[model samples]
Target chain A: MFSRDRWQEIFQTIGKNKLRTFLSGFTVALGIFIFTVLYGMGNGLKNSFNEFFMGEATNTFSINPGRTSEPYKGFKKGRAIEFRNDDIDDIKKDFALYLDEITPVISFSATARYRGESNSYSINAIAPPYGDMQKTIIMKGRYVNAHDMAGFAKNIVIGRLVEVDLFGHSESAVGKYLDVGGVMYRVVGVFQDDDGDNEERMIYMPYTTRQMLDQGTDKINEIMLTYNTDIGYAGAMAFDLSLQKYLKAKHNIAPDDQNAIYLRNMADIVQRNMMFANILQLVVVFVGIGTLIAGVIGISNIMVFVVKERTKELGIRKALGATPASVIGLVLQESIFITTIAGYVGLVLGMGILSLMGDRFKEDYFISNPGVGLNIVIMATLILVFFGVLAGYVPARKAANVKPIVALRDE
Target chain B: MIVIKDLHKSYRMGTNSLHVLKGLNLSVEEGELVAIMGSSGSGKSTLLNILGMLDEADSGEYILDGVPIRNLNETKAAKYRNKFLGFIFQSFNLINYKTAIENVALPLYYQRVNRNERQEKAMKYLEKVGLKNWAHHLPSELSGGQKQRVAIARAMAAEPKVLLADELTGALDSKTSYEIMDLIQEINDEGKTILVVTHEPDIAQMCKRIIHLKDGVIVEDSFVEQVRASSYVQ
Candidate 1:
């Protein structure tokens, strides 16, 4: 019956103390805002990475050679061993059934020139199957073929940045002459990468040409491989270990050799970044929870004080046939009223800030667009109600305990 | 009807015990209009507190509407008080933020009274206290007399078995006090039990019975009341 009046009183009190209430709410809002932004960033980072790693040779492995270590059947202390082209053939032929595609690469940085424009660049000498091995999106032109690779043709492919620099934004850079290290090569293809800068400073040439060009280099710089199925993650991992062991034994190398060749799977980068994001999100939630707790406690303390002020009124109500439940309800309504209004204000402000931020900023490393979906809002709402009830507990009990006589006597 | 036996109450301020009531015994029957008079520290207010269940009797028994209250817990005590008690204080004790109708509607909040019904009843009671014209006026806007009238209407709203008033006219001018006294007496005549405490003999004399206490013990009980006729008796 009196619940209406209780709520009315709650709102009235809040309306009376607008500044204090807003401050408390602001703390809570800040907590939620931090958590929401962190989580959104985590998601945004995930989105960015997903965009970056658009499915190519996802679970793949490679093997590189190392230096001689211990006495591997009478090897010298500093004897360096390496894999020849034939050794690569041996591995590929032996693992042909399991192999998706393997492309050996050899390269070095040099200047790329078109007409009068010459820009410093890295030469990426890849096998004809390197396009499939690179597993990246092509923006223009066609990829080189096995025949072109076997014949060691001067055909070339470039990244969008390189294409822009070499051909001045011309889309049909294919078949055009691009001078790499003063040698003319025909542009065959172009690619678009998320980090255009990383790609623009590179030139792709036939692996055979690059290998022959480096007279001192008997082995390729790297090998990239892909698998057709993902169930082979474990198999792929084991194979990678075995391949490393094979290379070590045949090349007679030590495990700790600084110059030892090693594999770097892009999947590992993605996994590590994701883990970083998750940990970041956890930290954000802890901060948010801390803020919520502070706000809730403030609300509780203020509610207790409010109840104390209303002691005589409660007494009078009790004496006038108000049940303890009613008294409790009255105080509870006040607490919930304050919390609901305050929390809602906080939520709106938090979400509003996030929305505004989202509108203003593009996805970046530390921040993403602000978002408060149903889940976050609903959770905050529940927290507000719970905080309200907890805050109201003592006050409600005090009101219920008021002896009509003593309450009336209270000043 | 109400019965209190051997009611003892004390407040602990640090280690010192301030005895407010010591083995006080009192009784008020149905439809009785009574006043308990005492000076400061005479425990008149304490007696009122114990009677209203705003404080507990250290070791005592009290019965209201046939139910013994010594065994009641804090919450139960409040329920008992709410079920059968109504209180009016010298300060009027009206929630200052509430409009007259809302003030009158307060006690009913605990009663789980439906909203429409409670509003209707509050309006009805406000009219009875002659504050219907200012139903929306908050206590601050009302004169002391008007505030007390609103308080009186609030006390009457729950239809409690007993109305307890402490220094009901202490803050009011003579004319307003007399008017409030008349209203209270009229309410009592309507068959509601009331127990009022005051130091003013004139105020006590308004009741059908007066109990005077000094030092927490009743010194006198009387049936003789200073009779004052109201021009608008109804």
Candidate 2:
């Protein structure tokens, strides 16, 4: 079936009929080209959604203190509520099965001086588990540990940008001392955050040290924790309601008060954004398939016309002792060859365009690094070529079965 | 060599059938140059089509080179046609894109001849037709006589037992017609059985035997004094 002479004959025909070959090839190429570009753009949009919504830990909740709006149990309305380190132990003990990790945050702004380079930065004094909840990536040294908290040690973990700012990119900030608000704190680590430069510009220290600096009080500004993921969405929502009620009762605030304790659940937000991204991808794939179908139709139409055009030549070949099978093989092989080559050309061109446009559309169009996987595009091309064979086969069979007498007769 | 007995053929034109060949009987021996003569609608082409295995006789006994040609499927018929008969059409019927030598090599290619031998045989045939220098030229680039010569070379390349020519000179001027007829006579001198279908009396006189047909039946069959076409060709 794979004869060099047959291939040579097909090449001669194709070379002689340039317009016919180009017409058929252009249809297939254009079809795959549109499909690749659309699929890549869809992936880019999904990437953007992921980068925006998935920057931090998804199965987490953070609660902040607010002024009470209702009076309850002798506590007057308009009373300011506060969370302390003891509340962390209470939640951990009460919800041990549902809680993965918990941390307290004491936020303050301070100007730090390291060798005369000073910058005002937000400082969060936190426990060790805060590193997991925030998904912090440590670049140098280590985070604040239990020993530092128990000893009330003045050790801090600075952000990546903070290190560059204080040390001017010439020195490692780890193990170096920086004077902040008249107190000297040794930097123990440098960390980075995917949530962009804002998270990368802050500093972290032991909460016990911060509490000691504040006259040894146990006051904390906020509480953060990640729940066990095996508890699905419904379980997480139930946990959120229960935690809210417990915090309200502990702070002596009214049950229906909305301002006493503010809570944000990352799981619910992530789920909603994920659903939107999936729907967007579905729409893109639907359009891509439509393009491929149009391409198939286009190739089918061209093949029919080509067979009609070659009726006389086919008659001559048949008269010269060409079997019906040989006639069909010639046409079918030519169709497959053109479709496969043209589809590959379209795939390569689309990928090249995507890489050249890399991240240029991210800020304006929410399409980041637009491209499709090689396996996906190749599979799509093979499907198109398969359909191309069907398209060529119908007309080829018709031409082959035509009686030479009828075919050679003047039209 | 060829034989036919009680050959019958018809065409249905939308319910009404037109009988083309009605119970025809004929025979010819090897090396005989025979001409079939008829006017339009006289079944000359239809008879030639059946003889060439391009069409089937509805009910008849037909044999070529000792092989009975009846109830044969398309593939078997194609093989028989390729191995036992050669055809020269009025319009030349060359594949326009292929060069003369490639066109000549087509039949040998179907016969499974290797490339080098197919080329060598095609070149030999082109030399026989006095067009060896035009072997690489496409049909469109050749003149009418040269194109017909290429078609003749292509038909002869397979070396079949019988050569069938259907109005082989109909599309050419008288001078070129005589030249083609002269070539046909030279081939017949090689002991190959040949049948020429034509309406022209002069073309028929060039053959050793002539069969006249009318209204789908043989009206006359007789041997005539052969006129050599080479005497008239310049």
Candidate 3:
């Protein structure tokens, strides 16, 4: 199997028949190239899906209060529902085993001024855990903590764009005093949001401070909480249903009310989007495999033609004392060599093209960082080579087993 | 040395069978230069094919160099052909892609000889055929006579016990034919057993004995006064 003589003979044949070798090699290379590119693009599409639907925490749920549309327990059908601070404590005490973090949000738009600059920014008053839920990357100082909430401290965390607008780009926004709606607040942190520019233009503060400024009201505009991930998807769904039921009952709303409360479960959206992405990837893989099969058939056709063309040469070799096994070995080894080398060439070229086009198609085509894993590409190449051997074997065996007299008789 | 007894061969042609060799019997002693001659379709080629082990006889006993050649598989037949027999065809079937030396070294390569020794032996055989300077030239670059010389060198490179030439000079001109026959005679002079198959009377006259076949059976078997091909070389 490791005969230098055999390899030398193969190289001589390949070198002498440049066109024949190139034709067969080109078929295999194109197959693998298309396969790699298709697979990488599929992965890119999945990346885009994940970024769009699952950029924030998947375990967190946001519940917003709305007007009640169904009457229950003597409440009118058009009653306006509201979430109070006591509801947060009730949910925490009831779902303590399944809850990870809880936060109440009191959002309002306010004009913030610092020295000479002023801009209207949507300000969200929340707890420390809200930073994790929103996936905020703190650039300077820190988030609103428990001590600030307890003391109702007028400390604020500004978004990146908010800092740029009111404080300008030249100076740090942290530890600076900013005026919001006639109140002076000290900026404790400056942060960035991956959810894009709109999120980066907002500001955050302690909910206790916002409530104190609201004439000591205990009302919250929205409630957000993260559930323990040890509970799987099914458990998360069940928890969502139970939490909705509990909230509706506490508000004295109808069980089947359409508009009493609204719940947005990130887990459910993430799961559905992931399913869609997987199906798309499967389709791409099938197309890739089909291309590979076409390549195998292409190489097979070329090999059959090659063997037929070399009938006379093979007869000469047999007459010179080449065994049937040696004849088969020669053709099989040549096929494997050509396929392996060509497959690698295709893989490298495809990967190079992908890297060169990295993230360029992210906005228009929803294909982010398009590329394939090395292990998968290598496996695909090996499969093609194996088929290449089969393609060569069938024809080589027929030629090898042919009698020299019959072969010589062929013109 | 070769012996064939009661050899029979047939080819199936659609619904009928054509008998090629019908119960033929022949024997050649060591160092014999024999020529088998006949018209086309007289089974001369079929006989040569059987004797060279390229085709097996339907019912026959073939013994070459004290080894029985019956019911041997492809590998054994190939080994025997490599070790005991050398063949030369009219077309001088040298692999076109290979150089003269590479073509000559092919048989040695099949014999599992090391590269250096194979090249040395191939070069020696090329020198024997008076083509040592043309050893590195491709077959396409050589003349018909030179190509036949390379083929002959390749056949002899394996050091077989017998040399079989089937119309060895058919593709050459009258002068080149005689020149090739001269080389054959020189090889036979060195005590090598050789059989030349040809229909040409002049070619037959060059051998020490001639067997004429007609319709798959021998019509005449007789000794001849050998005409040295060297005398006609000019």
Error of 3 at B101 (Å): 0.2
lDDT tens readout by residue for model 1, A320-349: 666677678766765565566656666666
Which 10 consecutive residues of model 3 chain A have the lowest summed lDDT?
A47-56
Q: Looking at the true structure's interface, with contacts defined as alpha carbon pairs within 8 Å between chains A and B, what fraction does model 1 recover?
A: 0.71
Put down candidate 1 lDDT per residue, B140-232, tens digits, no spaces: 899999999998998888888889888889999877788888898889889999988888887887888988888877888889745663532
Best by DockQ: 3
Candidate 2 per-residue C-alpha lDDT over A1-411 given as tens digits, one digit per residue, 9 for 90 to 100: 588988888888889999999999999888889999999999999999898866778999999999999888988899999998889999999999999999999999999999889999999999999998888999999988999989999999999999999897879898999998779999999999999999998899999999999998999999999999999999899999999999988888899999989999898888898999999999999998999899988988999999898888888888888888888899989988889899989998888888887999999999998989999899889888988888888888888888787788745
Cα lDDT of model 3 by residue, A262-300, tens digit: 999999988888899999999988988898889888888
lDDT of each: 0.72, 0.91, 0.92
Candidates sorted on lDDT, descending:
3, 2, 1
Ranking by TM-score: 3, 2, 1
Q: Interface RMSD (Å), each candidate?
A: 3.1, 0.9, 0.8
* TM-scores of all predicted structures: 0.79, 0.94, 0.98
Candidate 2: RMSD over Cα atoms?
2.3
Query: By summed lDDT, which 10 consecutive residues of candidate 3 chain B come out lowest?
Result: B72-81
Poorly placed runs, candidate 3 (over 4 Å): none
Q: Provide the TM-score of the second chain in candidate 3.
A: 0.98
